[model samples]
Structure formats: C-alpha cells, structure tokens
Target: MFLSEPKTLTTSRGTFSYREGGSGAPVVMIHGWPESSYCWEHLGRHLKQGLRVIAPDLRGLGDSERTEGQEHYRKQELAKDVISMLDELGIEKFQLVGHDWGGIVAQEVALAIPDQIRKMVIMNIALINNLKGNMEVIEKVRSGSGKAYWYQHFQQAPGLAEAMIPGAEETWLRFFLQGWSNDIPEDSIAEYVRMYRIPGTPGAGANYYRAFADDAKRWGTLSDHVWKIPSLYIYGNKDRVIIPEYLNHIEDCFEEIRVEEVDAGHFLQEEKPEEVAGHMNGFFETD
Candidate 1:
C-alpha cells in the first residue's frame, strides 16, 4: 500500500501529487479542503473491482506545489490542475468523483471537457452557483441554531488564517476530522495532521476558502449551459456545513441528476465507504 506518501506527476502547470491504485476504467477522485488524496483511501479500497482510481490533492493543498498568492487557488485554476495531470497521463476519457471542494472543481471539469467525462459523482458539496445561496442559509443558521461559519469568516482575513492556523492546525483539523464523521479512522486524522504540519500547507488550505468570491465569478463566465452527462449527488444527511435547503434548484444545472442521501456526516465517504462506493460503482457500471 502506497499509503505513507503519494506519487507525483509534473505537468505543464507544475508538479502535483496524487495517489493512484487498481486498474481498469479510469476514475479520478478529488479530495476536499484540509484533506489530501488520503481522504479517498477508504472508498478506494472498495473500488478495486475494475477501476483505476487516481485521487489528486488539489493544487496548494496536500503535497501539491503551491504558489504564494491565494488567488492562484481559485476553483477554475484548481480544475485546471486536474485536467493537466490527466492529459499528461494520456487519459482521454474517465469517470469523475469529487468530495467537498473537489465536487465544485469536478463541476468545472465537467463543464470544461464534458465530452471527456463518462459520468460524474460528487459528495457533500454545492456547485458554484449555489454558493451564494448557501452563504445566505449559513447566516440564517448562525442566527437561529448558532451554527457558525467560522472558516468563511476566518478565511476572510487570509493573513490571519496563515498566521493563526499553523499554531492550532491540529486542533482545527480535529474539530472537522473527529466531528464531521462518526467513523473516520484514527490513522487518517494522524495522516492529515502530519500533512498540514508541513510548512505553508495551512495557508494553502486557507487559500481555497479565500478564493470563494473569485470562484463564483470565474464559474459565472460559463453560464446557461446545462450538463448532459449522467451525474450523481451523494449527500450526507448529517452534514452541518450544507443542508437540504441548498439543493432546491440543483436540477436546473444538469440534464440528468440523482441525489442519494447517506446516513452520515460531512465526510460521508469516510463514514460510509461501502455505501458510498456502492452507489458510485452502481452508477458508473450501469448502462
């Protein structure tokens, strides 16, 4: 098991790191923020039937090379990293799966190269268009249930994020790693903490949050075109960051969309790998 560290690939953009395993139809898995390709390890185990899974750490996060500015971490640019690495690998067509921010980037990839995506699957993430409405809901939650959007508020001051996060990286990660999923492995938490402990990773992770407005505007440029490919949305019923209210109009963005809710929290794949992989496998394998 190449679990200790992932393999690296140098593309035209820069050198990026990824973990690839198994063989057969290509399946690229994109991990979310504060998570490297490591988050997909649990689900990758079940996808060994006939799938070659390649999980990439989005640019600036995980072990990927990072540029100084937060602006370089926008979703469109993140999507470009994935596209470049795949192109370098000579992968012309493949299935796509993303969780958290990766889900949003997957949307960008689907939009950019729709002809190359055989199918798509996303978990616990809102599309760029839905982010504006999501913020509104977050405010209502803040006033009602007091569910704070600390990350958003904190990342609003990127400088502070870089300064403060490093000292308390483990604590911050613990809140999400232990709190978000009921069944995430202890080793997974340790692995993420170890990764974040590397210099600049904390700031790079924050860059993703810092680029929210830029992502929304960048994604806005590719509007009004509906995706015709088959896509599946796997939602975690217990996710605190995103609620059912946010997905009310997701159908408008795609031609064929199916939503499957799992009995878990934000890290649904980590919490329910079998169920998550089952849905993805069934969806991708079917006619």
Candidate 2:
C-alpha cells in the first residue's frame, strides 16, 4: 500500500509525469478525464503485493506536461505516453487497466502494442468505435436531458469549465466523491483534490473531451481493429455517461473478451473496490 509521488520522464511527445508503486508483474493504470493517477490509489494498493502498479497522469492532467496542440490530447497520443512510460521504466510487457478517458487510452494501447500486453481490463467504457455507434448515448446527448453531465462539451469551451466550476479541483473532487461512489474515504478525497488542484490541470483535463470529439468525428464509421490479447470488460450498470448497450458489439472487436457488470455507477472501482479487485484477480488468474 504505497505510492511513488509523481515523477517526470521525457518522451517523444514531451515530458510526462507518472507515479509507480507495488511489486511483481507490471500493471499500469490510466485514469479518465478530470482525474489524476489518484483514481487508482485504492485498487493499486490492494493489488500491490503480486502486481506492480504504475499510474500516470495523462498528458494534461496532474503533474504531466500539458503543451499546446489538441493533437497531444488524441487517444493514440496518450497510448504513446503509456508506452514511453513503460520504456522509461525498462518494462517490456505488462497488463493494463483504465477507466473513463483512461479506458479509451487503454484500448488504444492494447491495439498499438498488442504483443506487449498480457491482459487489458477496461472499466465503464466501451470501445471508442462502439461508443460512437451507440445510439443511446447519442440520443441522450440529443435529448438535452444530459446537459448536466454532458456539460463536458461546455467544459471544453475556452476558459469556461475552469471558470464555471469554482475551486475546480475541490469541485470535481467533491463531485466524484458524491456522484460516483458511496463510500469514498476521507483521506483519499484529500489526495484526490491535491492532484486535481495542480496548475494547468483544468485545460489539460478538458483536452480529453476535445480529443474525444475530434477522434469520434474523424474516425466515425471506421471499423474498429480486433486485438488478440485477453480482455475483461467491467461496467457499472448505473453508469449514465456510458450506456451498457455500447458494450454489446464489443466482443466483435476482441478475440478474447469477458464481460462483467456491477451494481455501481461510472466510478465502479471507487464504489466497489473489493468486488472489482476480486473479479480482476479471478479473471487474471485464468489461463
């Protein structure tokens, strides 16, 4: 149950920051938008004994270098960051786990380096291509009833997300604590806010959405690539941002896939860590 403070490593793209902890087989955890590596703190500590967990703040979030260019926010760009982080640590192979935007990054990483990953665990996310094709999410967005959550697009608007959400870090910290999980520990919330409050955090965080929009628009209608790696799909049945139907055709894109549902929301790991970890151990133990 230990975490290395954020450290910087130079990559082909730019200087990236990440945290490492635990021991044994490498397991890199990438967090979604508006979150730092802190999102995996609980699960990382629990899995530390047999798994070396490395959590990195994506390009614009946490302490990672956030430079100009929406290109830096592309999903593939984040995947490159993961590869570069592994290379910096001299790790040739590992497992991957990601949530939200991090889940999107995990998908691309598994595709970009299929041979390097042993297994991939995606939480509360469908494939980017599948998500694009999901009519439910589109209908929700079109209905305008999603304005409260889909306000992500508004957050991407220049200077608005940061401005509207006063004490942006604390605002989001409290938001997720209350919105995503039912039993968020007090100390964890403190740590979560610490990273979220860092400088340049807002724009870098919001860049995730900007890249998501571009990727969805550009790659729309393109069939997704199938990867041979063993994969696990865990989604919260109550997740509002992503409908469960998005995961329906996901098996068509992966050679080996298993799906599990939990009685939680978008932040399943936080809400049900023990259940999530139990399933993860059971699935990863499979031959």
Candidate 3:
C-alpha cells in the first residue's frame, strides 16, 4: 500500500496531519492545493522502500486544521508549519519535494531554513517572479488565453470565490483535475472532491490564492536572495497551468539547478509517479 496510518501533531501553527513510513534519511513530501497528502500515495509507496517519507496535508487543505484569516495561508506562514511539523517529529535534516503551491511553500522553507534541507525537488510550479521579465507569460495567464491561470486571479478576489465554489466544489475541482492532467483516475478526483466538501475547506484553498499579494511582496523583498541548495526542477511538457516556458528564469533564482521534462501534464506525480519518484531518488541519493 502507501504508508502507515495518518498521524497528527499539534504544532505552533495548528493540528498538522501527515503520513510517514519506512526509515532512513527523511524525505518530506508536500502536496499542493485542491489535493491532499493522498496525492503522494503512489510516489510515497515507492520512496518509502528506501527512504523515510513524510507527506503532510498543507494547512487547511486536507485533514489539517484550518487557521482563520488569509494571512495564515501566506507562503511563509505555510513554510513555518512545515518547520514546526519537523520539529515536532524530531527530524533534523531532510530532502524536500513539493508540487504546485506546495512547491512555492518548499521554496519558502528552503529560504527560511537552507541548512535544514539537503536536496530539493520542485514540480509543476513557477517559483521565479512573474514581474521580472515574463510579462508576456504573465499577460497570457492573466488574460485567460491558451496558458491561462485565471484561477490565480479569480481566487485573489475576496468573497467571490468563496461564494461561488462552496456548493459546486466537485464541478470546479474536476475542471482543473481533468484539464491539468492527461487522465486522472475518477477515484482520485472523487477523493479530492470529498475533502473539499468539508465545511470551510473550499475557503482554505481559496485563502492560499487570497494571500497572493503578501506572498508576492515577501518574494520581491527577497529578490536579491538566491537559493544555494542543489535543486531539481521537474515539469510536464503538457502542463497548461504552468507552461514549460516558466522554466526560463529558474536558473536566475537558484544557485544549483537541473531541469527534467515529462510527457504528462500538471499533475505529474499522479500521471507519472514512477518517473517523478525516480528523479527524486536519483537527485536525493546523490551528493
């Protein structure tokens, strides 16, 4: 199967829920929005054979407790939750992996505690600043074109997303799951819908995007900072949400980085778990 049963930790942030299995150097897996730690089930099953795997549902996303206010969902604050969870678990150093918004949080974690992370893998996320020189891509995403990321803009607007997304969560969640992946299993989609249906769950997802301005400001303030950790950048060639073109500026942001392209779409771990886990194992195992 995947791993041991879920465990809960009361951290400085709130009650954090995670799944852990195997033994050895820890590999913390952070899942992105609209999905829970369940997203890592397949990848975790493989990685757990050789490495201790820790996958946590980001605050307010899955079984984790929801903290009130948009500020609680800021990327930096989310990073703190990861750090707090590690503290509670008594883990000192570990490898990190994240997808989508989770990738953004991973970047923040690395920035916050560079020494705590050994190697890192960021999947299907644009970690670089969009305002730097990617105006064309930014405009396309904002205008809802072929590579439209309209949801980012949509979620930033207060009350609108919360009002529209609650009751019709499944329909909205399925649109992204189907549109972003080559063919996600219906059961996976149903599981995500079930989680989002929890009272106040949809709002927590929206809060991640709602904190975009604060995240952007915090990112800009740290623009001169560069990530020193060895990093692997994995992206799917067919990922419409975060197009491969977004990889253009990654080198400028990180000191040591390598790029890999897969044939799947945005939800690469779901569509190509073996490939994703293979890359992670290779990078994390090497010096």
Q: Write the per-residue lDDT of candidate 1 for residues 1-287, one digit (tens) a residue.
A: 52336888999889899888878888888999778899887877876477888888788778889778877788888899899999988999899998999998998888789899999998888766554446566567867856446777687784887788787878989988778779688878888888888888877888888888787776666456567889899999998887776676778767899989899999998899889988887787522
lDDT of 2 by residue, 14-91 (tens): 787888887788888898866778777776555525777789888877788866667788888888888888888798
lDDT of 3 at 231: 88
lDDT of 3 at 155: 80
Q: Clashes in model 1: which pairs?
A: none
Clashes of 1: 0
For model 1, state the Cα shift of residue 257 in Å.
1.2
Task: List the lowest-lDDT window of 10 residues for candidate 2.
Answer: 128-137
C-alpha local distance difference test of each model: 0.82, 0.76, 0.82
- Candidate numbers sorted by TM-score from highest down: 1, 3, 2
What are the per-residue Cα lDDT tens digits for candidate 3 across 56-126?
Answer: 88998878887779999999999999899999989888999989999989988888888988899999887
lDDT (Cα, 0-100) at 82 in candidate 1: 93
What's each prediction's TM-score? 0.92, 0.89, 0.92
